[model samples]
Target: MKPTLAPFPATRLRRTRRTPGLRDLVRETTLTPGDFIWPVFVRDGEGIEEPVASMPGVMRRSVDKVVEAAVEAHALGIPAICLFPYTDPSKRTEDCAEAWNPNNLSNTATRAIKAAVPDIAVMTDVALDPYSDTGHDGFIENGEIVNDRTVEALVKQAMSQAEAGADIIGPSDMMDGRIGAMRTALEQGGFRNVLLLSYAAKYASAFYGPFRDAVGASGALKGDKKTYQMDPANSDEAMRLIERDLSEGADMIMVKPGMPYLDICRRAKDMFGAPTFAYQVSGEYAMLAGAAQNGWIDGDRSMLESLMAFKRAGCDGVLTYFAPAAAKLLNG
Candidate 1:
């Protein structure tokens, strides 16, 4: 129902805004630690935490350090942490077989986190770019990103994550029919409880540059990902993709590079009424944090406001690098 207000001073529209306590009473949107899915970078080592040059305040931690980070994040009430590995250049291959290796960086990190912080959900990124010589999510054959072949590889990769006890399998590959294929594999492979958070409406945007650098794909990428990732101009296409993914057994759906695509996020939620999420991609984090460091924006306030915007836009949760900071502030 639409809120009806008095025509004159009787309404006193400023009454709620005049005080923080009153404003909290009337607040329509709220953000909490549980609303975040923190994304962390994993390197291969012990006790190492290398700063990501592109994303300020973000670090690529070794497996043991990642386990420590997971414990810290869970203690802050953040329910989930997503893993992206900084694959060694030597491991990048045409077949991307490293992606499915049972003891690769991502799998090892998953197992470590699950063992250390079993209550906090461990989400794994299922993409080939981190392990691909071409640095594309899908495999290339004769100068083309072949969809079917990539989907097959993605199934194998997801199964490995499941085997490692990943709570959520995030298929960010954007390959056609990969969700259904992975879903079938998960069910048949005896891991039916694993959640499928499909990156159904991921756009191939300039916002992914920092992410590529964080995962060490920037130097290896041979061509643009425009062929597989959705075009930035299409809105209707996003709806179709989300609908199809849900039909294919996606338990949840996500819109990537979030701030720019909140409209897609809103539409996806309103259209499908599923648990919708947005990824505040690395470039978005860099721009905001970078400006804050330069004294252009109030860092803490800006971060909180930006995260609250996701809740207002109808997202059930968001994947962000600012999880711990935001959780700390909100917990206060």
Candidate 2:
């Protein structure tokens, strides 16, 4: 039953806030290690862990090291690990054929992680940006981002991830009808159990600069992603996108650039009552980590607070760079 408050004098609200035990008892929202989906960068190499300068503590792990990171994350009580490939510029092509190569860095990493840590769920990014020479999620047609062609390419990408045994296929490309297309393909391709975690309300925010650099897209991108990604100023539009994705066979929904879009996450969860997630994007991590390194904020406290905020905002889980760190603290 929900707690009820009496009149000001009778209630004595300060009484509950007075003690640590009392505060714990009344706390409505809880954060846990299991609530994290750690996002890791994958590259092609052996035993390599390259630090991302933009995101201090974050590293781009080669396929072998990514498996190790998966095992560590599983031991930390994180339930899932999301993979994003840091593709080499040389491999990028206009056709983006490497995206569904089955032996690409992302697919190789997925197979390695599942083989080593099959108990932990494996999530793969299903977008062409990492392999696209154009550095756009969708194909470019006469200076415009084309939707239908992108959806077809995304289906191929999703199929490869599923074939590699990815438990969750995250379509971060915001092309309309791609969810339904992927769903139909997954069903027919005999990977009926794979989950579609749609990046339903992804925004074209300045907060993605660090991510672009990590994925080697900073120099390749021709223009802004605003044509495909949602506008930062629209809240109601987020609702529309979330509902549309869910209706199109998405098992879960996510709002990207997490902290800044908690309202969207909250609304999505409340309205759809589906599995809702948020991406604590690279730029968000940079801001907090940078400030803490500069002694402007308490790193551990700020990280914990920011994560708890997501839980209170109704996120089922968060895709965060600080997952292992935050999970360790929560476990302690």
Candidate 3:
């Protein structure tokens, strides 16, 4: 493609910007409900929807309330909903056995949503953070985060969610062989149709601070996730991880903490040409929300602009807490 000079005289960029209708006609990137995946936090209770302090408008809903939320999101035209849990402290364990419990917070929520709002796709986070007493995404042994053993547990966790009617199984643990292992188990267990949206390029970054708070993992976290999650300074390594996940049968790939990793999102999309998604993690939400709360930024305008950047960077969709707000604005 060669660059061409615009026709002169009437050749002003202002011509296209002359009116609201004209600007709408020339708009290049667009956002829609189909481009969103709503991530909601679930807690134990009934008729509950409690907001996270760090995330102004986001809530931790109970199972029954999660069903209601899913119905509302579907009516708003959102494509899917992802689940994260705020486990009871008593339920948390060093071995994270509750991670695969059929009646666990996430699994229970998944079953409720599938039964109540069967049309909305249900995506569950397949990591041990919320269940682990150590607040790590995987198993910890003798003060070290282990890999192979964690993958074994992750497989069981994935199967439980699948059996509970989850439409998509998202492996956010970043364990090397978990994707392939989960894929094989799902097939053997008669869930061959369940989608695997692997968190392929998740980075160990401070951006996840608010997320830790949302899931009640902040106080329990023993150490940083650097040993397992990718480093923020590497890009080539992200591509390698994305490639490996795809080869291992990942149906979709995600880059966490969306805005800071838009470059990685672009690279992953270009290199793999797969269904690439980005997580607009909680800290990013809190920063924007906090600034808006203090009159530092126009929250509404900035919110839409930030999400639009994801599409411009080649993300197929975004996992965001801003889904309902953005959907309402888009609908308007």
Candidate 4:
């Protein structure tokens, strides 16, 4: 039984809009530091804080610096920090053995952060692109990306991260059967408590240009990732992927390149009722920051508004470069 709406002026919709207190009281969505997952870039060397030119104000910090950042993020009430390694070309290999190395840059950073800030949740990216000479998320065979073989590699990567004290194993590699494989491996290895956050609807989009450059993969990438990643035009495909990952063993799921595919995020949340998140990827950050730097828009306002859109669209949290800034604003 739906209630009938009063006609015209009697409804008085503007009554709530007229006052800030009323607006705050009636707000449908809220943003906070706890709802943010800061994505940090890690590299080798000590005391290094190299700036990523493509993503202004974002730096590739060394392991020690990353630990410090984790401590600060914890103090700010941000629940998690995700690690993406900027692997050197010398470490890149055909088999991507370095990706599963327990002492690699990413794994080392994970250990350092966990040791320093025991209460902060550290998430690790489980993809071979950072260590692959071919710079594809999965293994390539005969100029084609193979599926099952890639899942085998990703499982090893996930297990290695779990060994390094990763609270969340984020498989950004969009390979089939990887989630089930990783889950079984974790259960057998006494890591049943570790969370698996699958990148279920990662799309092959032009927006990843800045990310490729940030991870130093632009030159190493042999070709596009269309075969493994989802097509940008298909929404039904995203739902299917989300369902498959959840059934396989994903504790949580995500949609990549968030703003453009918010429909996918909302759909995933509605259909699955699981913990749904979105990655506000590098290119999206660059666009807003670039415009703000040029005085074209109020950067702070735009940042909060953009993040709030994720909440309104049914996201549990957002992985954003704007985490620290937005968190500070929300705190203030």
Candidate 5:
């Protein structure tokens, strides 16, 4: 039943907005540390916290340092951490075999984090771009990024992450049939409890430039990923991808380049009523942080407001680089 509103003169909406406590009481959305999935970049080294020049205040950390960061995040009440590898150039290859190597930078970081911070969920990226010499998420054939062959490699990568104690497998490769394939492999390998968070509506957008640089793929990429990733123009296609991935056994779905695709996020959540998430990718972070650094906007307020926008847009959580800082502010 809907409540009937009083006459305009009798109603005073601003009364609720008159004070902090009143505004809190009337607030429809809330942001918290628990609503964040922190994205951490891993590199192969010791005692290294190399800064990503494109993304201010974000670093590519070594395995031991990643473990320390995971422990800190767990203490801050952040539920999960997502791992992205900054693969060494020597390891990048046409086959991308290093993507599934048990000793790979991502896997090593996953194992270390699990050992150190058992309570925090560990999520791993299932894509080949970090390890592919061609800088494609899938194998290239006749100058095209092929789908089926790429899924095979993704399955291997997912299985390796499961073996390394990753609690969530995030397949960001955007290849068809990967969700089902990875689900089958996980079940067969007795990793039935692991969750699959599919990057179902990832777009072929210009906003991923900073991420490519952070992962050291910018120089290696042969061409754009328009063939496999979704087009930014199609909203209906995003719904279709979400449906397909959920039907194939994804426990959750994500929309990438979050702020720009908020309508898609809201639609996905409204249509599927599932655990929906979005990635505030590197470029988005850069824009906000850069603006704030130049005294254009209040940084802390903007960060919290941006995260709250995700909740208002129907996201259950957001994969963000600002997780730690936002969490600290929320805690305070």
Candidate 6:
């Protein structure tokens, strides 16, 4: 006898695609400029817009240029802008005190943006890599990346950012107990409303190579981040980290180097149901931009689709290099 279930022919999946209205009606996730937190690189200079060779179409802007970019991003409806400084080699000290210096590049940019366009939320990266002489995310002593000492420094860095008028403190160093320390510091320092977006599920992946290049860390890095950053081979560890960070008072949690780790993002969102975010890191952006430059892909479509994937993965927002371009496209 023939099959009793007759191949389910009545359920035409393509029915949703027959019209734009139908497609919109059934769309599971939607992305907009408001869902993006643009990660910008700040360099110390005047009239500078240096292109990061590893990350095509991205640049390290001077304080003035950052103000301009902030204004543009604000007008484009991008709610936040994250600052990562390309610290000068001379400022890279073993102590990484420059990370908390009031005159540092990130602080300077934050102040300038606040002065010029206070409406745009200024997010600051609280990591030591940019200022560490050893180019590690934490202090290295006797060939070991110490934990408690690094958390202390991170608290200082987070407090410094908050004092500089940072609207969000993003601790990307992956050091243990840093979130609780920063949270306590912020509370004591009278920055009770400043948001903390912990890089909770960061993995030690080769995907950060281009990010290191963008921040001028690739050349200075002495060893791998395997000691602190989560291993790429593990997923349960990510959940543990997320829970720990949440318990430590993180206002939001992030999964770094986004695309390959969408599963982690999904799990974090499902488990915690907190304000979850993702970072579309430099390497992913480079690959997409490179392919588009070579005419191998439709850059615009691919960029938009890549961002939409984060929403589909249940992310509340994304830190992406494509922020400005994607925002302009959405606005248009």
Q: lDDT by residue for model 4 over 1-332, one digit each (tens)?
A: 99886676667788888889999989999999999999999988999999999888899999999999999899999999999999999999999999999999888999999889998999999888999999999888898888888888888889999999999999999888899999999999999999999999999988888888989999989879998888999999999999999999999999999999999999999999999999999999999988998999999999999999999999999999999989999999
Weakest ten-residue segment in model 1 by summed lDDT = 3-12
Candidate 1 segments exceeding 4 Å error: 1-12
**Worst 10-residue lDDT window, candidate 4:** 3-12
Output the lDDT of residue 142, model 6.
92
Model 3's number of clashes is 0
lDDT measured at residue 118 in model 4 versus the true structure, 0 to 100: 90
Give the CA lDDT, 0 to 100, for residue 63 in model 6: 91
Model 1, residue 316: C-alpha shift (Å):
0.6
Better model by TM-score, 4 or 6?
A: 6
Estimate, for each residue in 1-332, the C-alpha lDDT of model 3 and write its tens digit.
Answer: 99686677545689889999999999988999889999999999899989898889888999888988999999999989999999998989988999999999999999999998899999999999999888999987788889999999999999999999999999999988999999999999999899999999999989888888988999999769999999899999999999999999999999997999999999988988999999999989999989999999999999999999999999999999889889989999
Model 2 agreement with the true structure over 170-242: per-residue lDDT tens digits: 9998999999999999999998899999999999999989989998999998879999899999999999998
**Where is the poorest 10-residue window by lDDT in model 3?**
3-12
Tell me how candidate 5 scores on lDDT.
0.94
lDDT of the candidates, in the order given: 0.94, 0.93, 0.93, 0.93, 0.94, 0.93
Give the poorly placed runs of model 5, Cα more than 4 Å off.
1-10
Candidate 5 clashing pairs? Answer: none
Give Cα distance to truth, residue 112, candidate 1, Å: 0.7
**What are the per-residue Cα lDDT tens digits for candidate 1 across 122-232?**
999998999999899998888999999999999999999999999999999899999999999999999999999999999999998888898999988987989989999
Please provide TM-scores, in order, for all candidate models, with all chains considered together.
Answer: 0.97, 0.97, 0.95, 0.97, 0.97, 0.98
Clashing pairs in 1: none
Kindly list the per-residue Cα lDDT of model 5 for residues 1-332, writing each as its tens digit.
99897667587788999999999898999898999999999988899999999899999999999999999999999999999999999999999999999999998999889888899999999999999999999998888889999999999999999999999999999999999999999999999999999999999988888889999999988768899998899999999999999999999999998999999999999999999999998989999998998999999999999999999999999999999999999999
Backbone clashes counted, model 5 = 0
